[model samples]
Target: MKLTNKITIIALAAIAAGSFLALAQTPANNNIVDEIVWVVGDEAVFRSDIEEELQQLRAEGSALPPNPYCVIPEQLAVQKLYLHQAKMDTIEAPEGQLNNQVERRLDYMEAGLGSREKVEQYFHKSYAALRNQLREVMRTQYIIGQVQENLTKDVKATPSLVKKYFAAMPEDSIPYVPLQVETQIIMVYPQVPQSEIDAIKDRLRDISERVNNGESEFATQAIMYSEDGSAMQGGELGYHGRADWVPEFSNVAFQLSDPKKVSRIVETEYGYHIIQLIDKRGEQVNVRHILLRPHVSSADLEKARLNLDSLRNEIVKGKFTFDEAARYASHDKDTRNNRGVMMNQKTGSSRFEMQDLPPEVATVVEKMQPGDISQAFVMKDPKRNQDVVAVVRLTSRTPGHRANLAEDYNQIKEMYLAARKQEVIDEWVEQKIKNTYTRIEESWGNCDFRYKGWKK
Candidate 1:
């Protein structure tokens, strides 16, 4: 999920610079400086590959050490170990999958590299030729991932092991567990009464009628009436797949075949829509629409607020427990099952690192103490189209600290398991490098490696 360049560097994904015929000038052991840094069976690790990634890193403003060449070799060694294992285990992607992924990624890389022509010019090849080279490299990476996943499939965690793992970590080496608080609230969307919905629908039907009657152009009417962001641009949302859009909108949009005909009012969470499908291909559709959300009734807000006040009074009087109240009364489904214990959706754990919590929830939690409940307040729910009133529940709070076995067993166990897994993988790689066919280029004859037997 993270496209961050820093995370990519820290992961040490594929380490090795491609060693080419025209790389660093070194004619030490070999008469010709061109040498293979290491070989895995028939495949070789060159200085070029690592150098490219390092150059990419540097361009991204990474502060790199002067010793990237050394670090890259080890990374390349690990990647080769994985690559070798992948071939052995038949972890290979079909030509078609690699082709598709390469094509999709190429689009992004092309944009990043500036343009299609620019990219082709830099690589000194036509688009098709460049794609073929990228495909081969991508296929190797894909196979390596499959091999690693296969090896790690059986890794399991246990409570006792998790505890011991945390205990073994040095105090400073342990990650600081962030402060978190849990709470939940019930939200009632700002009210749009039936009459208002019907009025908006009627107005949309009139627009559709005008377009159908040929009295007015669809784009012009849309410019004057459409409420969505694309209104100014003639209501063109461009071509999009069904999966990319909200279900209700896509279902109707994708179904429309006639360009001249205007569709019925489509109701999505965004609002009511009257759409004109411009075109379609298989599961993809292009459409333009006018959206209208009904105005919220003040009476609806009062009704919700009055109900919340009654609920609050009941909680104060101990007539109903918070859990029971949330179960029977809360409208938000995510927390309703957990008795309204509002954990972050992005992180499954109940605790939210201060940075990880949603802004609205964080603001509420920041000003409150443990066990305090906020007065009913209205806030906009990002998922919904309207404002809603809900009370905040400030449960337990934990501050940042060095992880301990008692307070942070799960995290410790994860870290311990990860460390153990890394050690096991390292041992496996060491054995593989020793047993596999390997030859360091004469130019790299003097550089030290963790596995000394690789030279033979």
Candidate 2:
């Protein structure tokens, strides 16, 4: 009873547009009653919810399903089933993950709308209120995902089943594997001068001292100076476990027992920070901090580019192999030890489709052929929040072709496992719908549903 692709797309669009909140508010038409359209267990689905979803779909210029009235309510009803099961099982959504997701969503909204103020204006609520609402939506999504995972955790695609599944597929039904490449890179981080590092540390120390001496509030300092996304909320990082934070940040954050004390300057991959404890609950701690990053001078960047250019020329002239150079000279820790072969984090593989590479990397690699080394180029290293110079070698390329058992076993296996998992989930949803108590308004129940048991 999971939502069909059309419904799922509409739901995601509505959520992003903040139309989900319309369910709780009255419709603009004063004559139309906000009547209950369906009830599943103790939860009620209102007509306004369906109307709001439809309005969001129309606003986005999305084509509506022929039976949107029936489809939308059924989607809501199925969500209720998953939610109810999650509650019964006491499945708690990870708060740290939820907080991070909400923050990212807020950041995206702010970026799109031009500022935090515009985001609030667009949502018609205060930032805190909007965050809470987004948090609940994200929490529901997380719990539903967890519940679905729980139901299908044991489903697997064995080798025999994979072969059988591939054999049964019609010739036209087989998927096309896209052209992918394996790239090797050598990266050099532009060195920050000690003077810049010392300057940042000194600034943080001054901020910490001011807060400790009651000359300034830590929150105010964070708002004024913190470089992190949490600066909008006065650098407040809500309660999160030590595992949720980098070790350097968590170690100092958890050590703070006094709310009045300001922490010593702590350095992390992101930047330098001075923390102030807000509260602690069990293993989780909430804190506020201001972050400052040492500036990478133009001279340093030029030096890095020159060094990488020299190394690339040497490798191109066969003075040393690309892999050999990367092993000793590359600053990218993730790939340096692995002979500079980049792995796709999403797929846990050594191959990447063109669009999957970082934009800068993709642009350079697109024009390169197998065994060709690229010229030195500058790109942002998101992991360390710095700009780095690098050269890449396109080691191998696989051209696009139809998937087959011999050459595409792993890909086919993944496809089979995903299909099997969906089957298990769909069957579970069907049973849940049959067993669960449901009531629909007669007029709303007139249309057909994908799942049969909902009518009764």
Clash tally, candidates in order? 14, 0
Off by over 4 Å in 2: 1-31, 34-36, 41-43, 59-61, 87-90, 94-132, 259-261, 309-321
The whole-model lDDT of each prediction reads 0.67, 0.82
Instruction: Name the regions of candidate 1 deviating beyond 4 angstroms.
Output: 1-37, 92-143, 199-265, 270-303, 448-453
Determine which window of 10 residues in candidate 1 has minimal summed lDDT: 1-10
Compared with the true structure, what per-residue lDDT tens digits does model 2 show for residues 1-456? Answer: 222112223244355455533422322333446778888887778776677677666665678889999999988888889989998999999887777667666766664565678777766679898787677777778888899999988988889999999999999999999998999999888888999899999899888889999999998998899888778677887767789888999999999999988999998878799999998866678898888987797888889999899999999899999999999999888899999999999899988998989889999998989999998988988677678899999988889999988778999999999999988888988999889989999999998798889978
Measured against the true structure, the TM-scores of the candidates, in listed sequence, are: 0.70, 0.82
- lDDT by residue for model 1 (348-433), tens: 77877667665666787788888776666666666654667777677778887877777877677778777777666667778887
